[model samples]
Target chain A: MPKTIEEINAKIKAGKAVVVNAEEVIGIVREKGIARSAVDIDVVTTGTFAPMCSSGIYFNIGHSKPRIKLEAARTYLNDVPAYSGFAAIDIMLGATALPESDPRNKIHPGDFNYGGGHVIEELVSGKDVCLSAATYGTDCYPRKKLETWINIRDLNDAVLYNFRNAYQNYNVAVNVSDKTIYTYLGILKPRMGNAVYCCAGQLSPLLNDPWYKTIGIGTRVFLGGGSGYIAWPGTQFNPSVPRTEAGIPKRGAATLSLIGDLKNMQPRWLRGVSMQGYGVSLSVGVGIPIPVLNEEILAHTAVTDDDIPATIIDYSRDYPQNLPDVLGEVTYAQLRSGRIRFNNRDIPTASLSSYSRALEIANILKEWMNQGAFLLSQPVTPLPGIESGLAFKPLNYRPVERNNSS
Target chain B: MKVSRKIVLHFPARLVEEAIAYRLVKEYNLQFNILKASIIPDSEGFIVLELTGEQEDYDRGVRFLTKIGVNIEALSQNVVRNEDKCTHCGACLTVCPTGAFEIEPGTRRVLFMHDRCIACSMCLKACPPRAMELHF
Candidate 1:
C-alpha cells in the first residue's frame, strides 16, 4: 500500500512511526525484502559529515552608533575577509575565504591554518571574534574605522546559508606524478601511493534519496546538529551524470544548498578544517530524512556501499589541468576496506568523511522522528532531476573588455 | 634487566657535530637506532632514536648525555593526539610512514596508535581538524 507524506506525519505525531537509519534500513530490506520493508519502515534517515568547501554563513551585524556602511567597507572576521555587499551591517563569510596575508602555497604547500571557516566555527562555539572594518567616511555615516568583538548572541541573526553541500558522490583522488601532491583530498602520495575519497557511502543523504524523490526544496534536515531546511538544488546540481541500474550516480552528481539558524548549531558538527596546501574549509554535518512512502523509496534506501561507484582521479595532472581523464573506478565498499587495487598495485585508501559521525547523525535524526520531535515535509518543488536535462558547465575563459567606458 | 627507551636528544650548536651515537655504542654498550634527525652544521639540532641496553647502562648512558649538556626527553612527549579534537576522518592513515592509524573492521572508526608513531608530524598537517599536534 502506497503512503503519502501526510500519513507519515500522522504516524510520526502519534508515535507510531517506524524510523530507521540508512544503515539499518539496508539490513531490514534484505531481511524482509523491499515490499514488506516499505510497509514496516516509515522513514529512513541519512547523514554525512565531510569538508564541504562551498559553504558559508551570513549575519546581520546590528547597526553601530555612528552607522558605518559595511557594503562599501572592507570587513574582516578574525582576520578572514568576508563579503559585505549587502546592507550597512550585513555580511556573508565563505568557508574558504583566506586572509590577504595568507601565503596560500607561496612557500609551496603553504599552511593555511585559519580562514572564514575557522571564524564561523569559533562564532558557533560562542567565542568572541574580532570584527574589524575600514571604510571611507560618508556624510550620513561618518565612522570610517570600526573594531569590535562580536559573539553569536550579540548579532541579531546568524545563519548558515551554504550554496552547495552534501555531494551525492565524489571522486577518489590520487597522484600519478613523481612527487607528492597536497590537495583537498589530503596528501596524495606519488605514483598512487594512497587514494582519498570523501563520502559516507550508504549513509550519505543524496545517495539514499537518489533522483531527489523525497529530498527537495523546503525539506527539513538535521544540519550542524540543529534543524535546517533545504533551500534549493545546490550549485552545479547536475542530474545528467551516468548512473547505475539502481539510479545512483557513478560520479559526483546531485547536491543540496542548505539554510539553518547558526545560534543553536553545535561546534562538533560544524568544525573548521585545514588541509595542507589546500585552504581551510568547514566540515559540515548534514542529515536528511527519506519518507518511505512507497516501495521505490524503500528500494533506494536499501542500496549499499558496494552498489555505489566512485571515479578515481589523478589530482597532480588531470584535475589541475581540467583534463577529462579518469584513472579508474572503484566501489565505496572497496574504498572502505582500506586498500584498493589500482594499476596492479595495492594502494592504501583513506576517507576525508567520518563514517562514524555520519552514523551518529543518522541515529540522532531517527531518534528525533521516533520521539515525534521531527516531522517530514513534502517538497514544495522538486529539484531538477534526470528528466530536467540539467547540465553542469564549466567556466569558459574570455578576454575582459578593459575599456568599456570608451 | 634489558630496557629499550625511545628518546629525543637536543644538541647545542657546538655539539651538533659530536658523534653522539658512536659514543653511546662504544662507551656505554648501548645499541642505538636513529629514527629521525635534523641537524645542520654549527646549529642547534635534535635526534630521535631508540636506545636499548642493560637498565644500569641505560641510566648511565642518559647521565653521560646529560653531563655533556645534551637535553634528553621522551619521543612520545613531543607528539600528541587530542582525542576530543580528532574526528577520526582517517586523513593521517595514508600519509604516515608507519601505520599509526588503523580502522576498526566493523565500526570503521580510526584508532590512533601512538606507540607505532615515530612522531613524523606528517599527520599534523594532514589532519583536517589538526588533531595530531606536535609540542616541540
Candidate 2:
C-alpha cells in the first residue's frame, strides 16, 4: 500500500512500520522498482560518519556567582580555546581548535594527541575537564578570574551546534609535493603515494536527497549518537559545484549545519582526531532518515557507492583556495575496496571516515524509528539547486565599492 | 613444514664480508626473505629476515647461526614498523577499529598501542613509505 506522510506517522506512533536503510533500499528497488519500494518502505535511513573539520560546540554555562559581564573574557576548556564573542557565558569551541600549549605544529610530526575535539570527547565520556577564564574586573562585577573543572552535567546548556557537519561530497586527498605532508586529510604521501577520502557516498543523507528537498531546517537527524536538526546551510555550501549527469558533485558541493544536545551524545561516535602537522578535528557520526514519499525519493535512496563518483585532488598544494588540478574521478566502492585505478595509475585508498560506525548509527536510527522515539520531518524549505552558483568576493576597490552601494 | 618467523641476525664487523644468507640456504636447505639488512664493513651489522623451512631444518639453522656468533632473536610483534621510515602520517588511524593508533597531542606524533590492535592489516598497504610490515 502506498503510504502517505500522515499514514506513516500514524503507523510509527502506533509502533508498526517497516524501515529499511539506504543499503537495503537498493535490493527493494531492483526487485519491485521505485514505484513499489516507495509504497512498501516507510522510511529509508541514511548515515555518514566522517571526520568533519568544520565543526564546533556552543555552550551556555549559566550565571557564575556575582555574574560578571565577561565581554573581554578569555575562556579555555581543557586548554582548548572556547572563545565566545558574546557578552556573557556563551562559549563556542571549534573542532579544529588546537591548545595554546603547543607553540606550533612543533610537538612531533603527526602525533597531535589533544585539541578541542578531544575535550569534547572527554566531556561526552563523562570525564571532567578544567575550565578556566580570565577577564578584567568591572566596578559592579568584582570577579576577574575563574578556574574550575566541569563535565557535561555542570553546564546549563551544552549544544553541539556545528556550523558544518555532513558534507554532501568530498574529494580524495593525495600528495604531489616532494615531502610527505601532514594535513587534516591525515598525512598525504608526496608524489601521490597514498590517497585518502571520507564519505559513505550513496548512503549519505545529502546524496539520497541530492537537491536537499528533504534535508533542511527542522529536518530531524541522528548526530553523534543523538538526535539533531539541520539548523542551516553549512559553510561553503556551494550548490554551484559542477555535477555529473547523475547529479553527483564532480567537486566538493553541498554541506549542512547541524545542532544537537551535547548531553545526549556518546564518545564512541564523537572521536578525537589529530594530524601530524595539522591541528585536531572531531569525527562526527550522523545518520539521517529519508522518507520514501514517492518514486523519486525511493530511486535516490537506492543509489549505490558505484553510482556516485567524487573527485580526487592533490592535497600537497594549497587547498580550497589555491587547489591543484583534479587528478581524476573514482567511485566510493572502488575507494572503499582499498584500491583505485585511475589515469592508468593504481592508487591505494584510505578513509578517515568510518563505514562500520556509519552502519551502526543507521541501525540505531532504525531502532529509534521502530520504538517511536524518533520521527521523520518534511523539510520546511528545500535548499538551492545546481543553477545557484557561488563566487568569491574579489577584493577590488571598484568592485567592492559597487557591492557596498548595493 | 612451512614456517615464517621474524628473526634478527646480528654479525660482527669481521663477518660483514661473508654471505650468511647464501650459506644458511645451502647448508640447511632453508629459505630466507631479507626484510632489512645493513652490513657496513668494519662495523656491527644486522639483518632482519623471515626464515621459512621444515621444522627440523629451522631448528638446525638457529643452532648454526648461534655457533657462528650471529645473534638470532625473535620479534614479539608480527605487524611491526620501521621507526626510521615511519613519517607518522596517521593513515592507519582511518582503518583502526580498536583506537590502537593514537596521535599524541602537543607533539603530533603517531603512537601505536599493539595491545588494542585487532591485526586487521589495513595499515600495511595504506602506509605510503611501506614502513608497516606483517610477519605472520
Candidate 3:
C-alpha cells in the first residue's frame, strides 16, 4: 500500500526522507520539457519513426500449454531509452487447463479454428508507466523512490498553494500565465513583498535545467542610479574564475577585497563574437555564491536607495543573527577602506577605439555562455582568442542612427 | 584540381515530357546530357532523371530545381519495407518473385530473409493477407 501524505510529511520533518527544494523541481520540469521538445523536433525534421515497435501479436491455444512470442523484433536503432529497457509478458488465462490437453502439443499447421475459441489480447499499457517510474526514481532518488515521490508531491503542493495566495493578493485571475508573471509584478503588485518572496521559491521547470550548473551569488553592487541592483545569472558564471585564484582576493586589489574570495572558481563558458560586454565582479572576503549572493546584496541595497553610499559593507549587520552576517562584516571593512564600489561604471563609451574592443568582449562572453565553462581550457584553435591575436581580426561595433518619428 | 559532378532528379513519371528538365539544362550553360529517364510503376506516379555536368554547375542546377518547387530527394538503392494488414494466412508462396519468405518447419510461422529479397515487390502484390513489404 502507498504511504499516506501525513506519514510522508512526518518522515520529511524527521529528516528520514529528503525534501524536494525549488531548484530540484525546476530542474525536473526543465529536463522533461527539453526531452519532449527534442523528440518532437527530431520526428518532424527527420521523418523517422521511434525505434520501438508499436504493434505486436500473440498467439495462444486455450487450456493447453500456452505459448507466447512477440511478432516483431525489438530494434534499438532510434536511441530511445524508454523502449530499450526490460519488458515481460503478463499472461491472463481465461479458463482452467484441460486434463486431456498437453501443454507441449503444437497446434496443427492448418488448424485455424480450434480449442473452444481462444481470445488473445496484447498489453501495451505498462510501457509508459514503467518507463516514467523508473526514470524518475533513478534520476531523483536512486536509493528511495517512495521518499522522492513524497517530497516532490509536497513541494508541488506548496508551490501551487503559494501561487494561489499570490493570485488572490494581487487581484489577478488564477489562470495568469508565466509569461505574464514579470509584467504582473511590475504593474499590479510591485510593492507586494510577500508576492516577491513567494515567487522566489517557485521552481519554474521551463526556465531551469538540473544538469545545467547554476551558481547563485549573493553580493552587493552599486547600480549607479542612486539605487543598488541585484543580478542573478540563474546559472554558473560563463567564464569561471581560475582555480589558483579561486576564493582568493587578488593582491592589493582594495575594492574587490571586501567581496569574499571565490576559491577554485571558473567561468561558466567562453564568449563568441555574438555576445559582448558582460562580466561579473566579486568581493574577496564574502562567502556567497557569486551569482545569487551578488544578486541578494544588490536587492538589499536597491531598497535603501541613494541614502547609502556605493560601498561593500555588511548589509546584514542589523540582522546579526543572519547566517551571512560574518561575511557582511568583512564586506563592510573592505567598503570602509574603499576597496569595492557599488558599480564598475568604467564602461567605455562608443568610439572608434573602444567600439571594437567592446564588441570583441561581447562576442567572447556570448560564446562562453552558449558553449559552457567546461570547454574553456580546451585549445581554441578554431576560434579567435578574447584578446587580439595573430590570426583573427578585431570585431567592430558602430552605433546606427535611430529612426526619429514625426 | 577539377572534379566531375552528376545530378539525379526525381519527379512524377507524367511530368517527364515537361519543359522544366530541358530548361534546366539551358540555364546552367553546361554540357548537359540525360543518361536514363524512367518511370517507376505503382509509386502513385514518379520519374527519375540522371544528369552529368561540372560539380559547380550540378550544385547550381539543384538550387534552380529547388527554387522552382520541385520535390527533390537523394536517391539511394536500398530495400524498401512495406506493410499491409495480414490475417496470418500464408498464401503468397506460389506468386512470390523471390523466395524471400518461407514457413517455419512445424510452427506455421512465416519468416522473411531480407538477403534473398530483390525488392521486386511481387509478394506485396500477391499476398492475400497483404503482410509482405519491400523495405529499403
Candidate 4:
C-alpha cells in the first residue's frame, strides 16, 4: 500500500502519523521487512551536523540617521569584511570571511579565533555586533561614515542563504606524505597517522533519499534548529557521479542550497568553528523528513553505515593537486569502529560531523511531526537526477590572447 | 608508599641559576623526568616533569619548592574541556596522543577522560569549536 504526501499530511493533521528517525528505520525494516514497514511508517527523518563553508547570511540593517548610500560603500560586521553591493544598508557576510588582522597560514596552523562565522553565531545568540560602513558622500545622502551596534532584533530582515551545504557524501581525508597537512577536514598527520571523514551516513538527508526521490527544491527542512526550505540544488551538484547498486554516491556528490530566517535560529545548532590552519566555517544542523510514498523510498531510508562506502583520498597529495586517484575504500561501519585497516596499517578514524548531534536533530524533527506541530511539504520541483546529465566542471585556466596585431 | 605524578615548576629569576632540580635529586631523593622546559638567563622559567618519590618525601619536596618561591601545580590542572562549548564532534580523538577522547558505544557520545590526558595540547588546535582550553 503506497502512500502520498496528501495522505501523510492528513494523518499528521489528525495526529495519527507514524514517524521514525533514520536510525530507527533500519531496525524496523529488518524486523518487519520492507513491504510491511513501508505500510507502517509514514515518514523517516534524517539529520546532519558538520562544517558547511559555503554558507552566508544576508541582512538589511535598516537605515542610517543621515541615509548613507551603503551600496557603494565598504562595510564590516565586527571587524570581518562583508559584501555591501546589494542595496542600501544591505550587507552579506560569508562564513569563511576573515578580518584584516588574521595572520592566516603564515604562522603554520594559524589560530583563526574569530571570523564571519563567529559574528553570525553571536548575532543569532542575541549578542550585539558592531556594524561599520564608510562611503563616498553623495548629494542626496551626505553621510559617509557610520558605526553602530546592531542586533538581530533591530535588523529589518536577516536570512541565512547558503549556496551549498548538507553534502550527501564526502571523502575520507588522510596524509601519506612525511609532513603533516592542515586541511578543512581537520589536521592530517604524517604517514597516514589518522583519517578524518565528515558525514552522518544513514542519518544524512540526501543519503536517505538517494536519487532525489523525496527531497527537492522547496522541500522543508530543519535548519539551525528552525524550519527552512531547500532553495535549489547546491553548487558543485554532480548527479552523474558513480554510485553503488543502492544509488549512493561513492564520492563527494550532491548538496543543497538552504534558506531560513536567521532570527528563528538557535546558538546550539548554528556554531562558529575555527579550523586551526584552515580559516573559519559554520557548523549547521540540517534535518529533512522523507514522506514514505512507496516501499522503494522506505527501503532507501533503511540504508545503514555498513551499506554506504566512502572513498579515501590523500589530502597531502592528490587533493591539493586536484587528482582523481583514491587510496582505497572503506565503509562507514569501519570508520565508526574507531580504526580502519589501510595498506596493512591500522589507522584511527575520526569524524568532524557529530553522529550524536545528528541523531538528536533527527529525533527532534520526528517529535515535531509526531506531535502534529510540523507538517510535510511537497517540493514544487524535483532536483536534477542521474538522468539529467549534469556535470560538475572544473575551471579552465586559459590566458586571454592579446590582439596586439590590430 | 611510592607515588609518581606530573607537576609543573616555576622558578623566579634569582632561582633560575640555582640547582633546583638537583636539590630534588640529592636532598629529597626524588627522581624527575623533564617533559618540557623554558629557561632564560636572568628571567623566570618553568618546567613540566614527572616526579617520583615516597609519599612523605613527595609532600616535603613540594613544600620545600613552595618555600623557595617555586610555584608547583599539577599538569592536569592546566588543561580542561568546556562541556557547554563541546559539540562532541570527535575531532580530538585521533590527534590525542594519550587516546583520552573516545566515542561511547551505542550512544555515539564523545567521552573525555581527564586522567588519561597528558596535556599535549594537540586537541586545543584540532577541536573546531575550540572546546579544549589551556589555562596556562
Off by over 4 Å in 3: A1-406, B1-46, B49-58, B67-69, B73-136
Error of 1 at A375 (Å): 1.2
Tens digits of per-residue lDDT for model 1, A58-87: 999888998898878899998899889897
TM-score of chain A of 1: 0.98
List, for all models, the DockQ compared with the true complex.
Answer: 0.70, 0.14, 0.01, 0.71
Q: Note the residue pairs that clash in candidate 4.
A: none
How accurate is chain B of model 2, given as a TM-score from 0 to 1?
Answer: 0.59
Task: Kindly report which residue stretches of model 1 are placed more than 4 angstroms away from their true locations once superposed.
Answer: A401-406, B1-4, B8-54, B60-77
Tens digit of per-residue lDDT, candidate 4, span A52-134: 99999999987677888788788999999999998677899999999998899898989999999999999999999999889
Q: Assess the local accuracy of residue A12 in candidate 1 as a C-alpha lDDT between 0 and 100.
A: 93
lDDT for B66 (candidate 4) = 96
Instruction: Indicate the DockQ of the complex predicted as candidate 3.
Output: 0.01
Better of 2 and 3 by DockQ: 2
By the DockQ metric, which is better: model 2 or model 4?
4
Q: What is the model-wide C-alpha lDDT for candidate 4? A: 0.93
True contacts kept of 3: 0.00
lDDT string for model 2 (A144-260, tens) is: 888888778988888998887788888888877898777767767767767888787767888888876567777889998888888888877788777777677766788888899
Better of 2 and 4 by TM-score: 4
> A1-406 in candidate 3: lDDT tens per residue?
2233244334434434322222232243355543332221100000000000011111121111222221121311111111212222111111111112222125311111111001100011111111111222223223211101111111111100000000000011111122211111111111111111001001111011111122112222111001111122211111221111112111101111111111121111000000001111110001111111122211221111011111111212212232212111112122212122223321110000111111222233223323332111111121111122222122366888888993
